[model samples]
Target: MRRNWTDTVVAMLVATALGGCATSKDKVLPHGDHTMLDVWNQETGGSAGGGQPARQLLDARQGLRRPLIEADVQAAPANNAAYTRTAANEIYRQFHRLPNPDLVMYVLPHLAGTDPVPVPGYTTVFPLYQRVQYAMPGERLEDY
Candidate 1:
């Protein structure tokens, strides 16, 4: 039987309304007298709950985070070789942009419409190629 879409939607709406009106107010979770703050305080050792105090926990964490010094930075050369390069070296390593030589054009002086007012000639520059090109990583990109 081909049921009208409007009738199907109305039936679904009625079913949903009836489901929402059901007298099922049963508790799904066990009763708890504590607020979320109370649980958080207990876990994080806040003043209201018993645990490691927040200050002492922070101190312990801070102690583990040893600050990096010049000597420390120099010590990990082998492990951090790839990461240690200056940003300029990193960008030009693989996908260096092929040089886009500029094309300089000189527009000759011309007369304007209706009134023969002379327009001054001007020089303009454009890139030789339509779009920028990139050299493949590790490819020889020098002038051949």
Candidate 2:
């Protein structure tokens, strides 16, 4: 009798465990009438056991089909031309300016090459210009 009772209790416990593993539709739907499978099928565009067409994703550029007009082109120039002449002048001045300033240097007396003759001290200037100048726009070398 004791052995039979234990076997029955064990079987009942196994059955209860298996039943607990089964999913209920209420648990998936929560507050709605639809089940988890229905929601998933709708989201993934999967036909819910029917002959319906699948939903398609839209392209990002589908709505931008308008052509540009002359007004757009005219407006563009003003947008970036606030300091056009000033910028051009500045650029021209920079390009026409000297790259390096003229430096006047004095050299001390030193031994000459090969013969080792005593060389006298002398002063010399370099660059000639105060600053290194660059050419202006469309400037010619002969212009300098």
Candidate 3:
């Protein structure tokens, strides 16, 4: 009888522990016929119950389109010759080059270390090209 009581207590403890590990299925219900689009329409007051036209609710600028008149057009300045010439020149302008010219450097030799040893002098020039680089075809000038 003592052994049976011990076994019964052990079985009850094991069952309680396993039950605690099990998850509730009530909150995990499957999504039925309703989809994300239906939920959005309901939230935005576009459903039939709201009494608002669904098209107007979906597009806020439904009736805002209008034709431009002469008053809406701004007049161009009479003296646009300079502006036109500048604009024409700008069409061929290459603005991506380095502003400063390439530099030439000269290194002088000297003796150094605990024991004095002679080092030879050298000269070096920069900018391997003679002219600055131009914007390549189809290259984005704004990136420069």
Task: Report the backbone clash tally of model 1.
Answer: 0
Off by over 4 Å in 3: 1-17, 28-33, 44-59, 62-66, 69-101, 110-122, 127-144
Q: Cα miss at 15, model 2 (Å)? A: 36
- Indicate the worst ten consecutive residues by lDDT in candidate 3: 74-83
Better of 2 and 3 by lDDT: 2
Report the Cα lDDT for residue 110, model 1: 96
Worst 10 residues of 2 by lDDT: 51-60
Per-residue accuracy of model 1 over 12-85 as CA lDDT, tens digit each: 99999998777465543465799989888877778796656777787888989978998888878766876566
Give lDDT per model, in order: 0.80, 0.69, 0.67
Model 2, 1-144: lDDT tens digits are 999999999999999999877979789656978888987777655668322324232222445556889998889878777547675666654344435656889999999899999999999988866555576655644433
Q: Which has the greatest lDDT? A: 1
Ranking by lDDT: 1, 2, 3
Clashing pairs in 1: none
Residue lDDT tens for model 3, 1-144? 999999999999999999867856655565678788777766666553344555566466656667767655544443454456666667865455544356788889978788998878888788757777655544646643
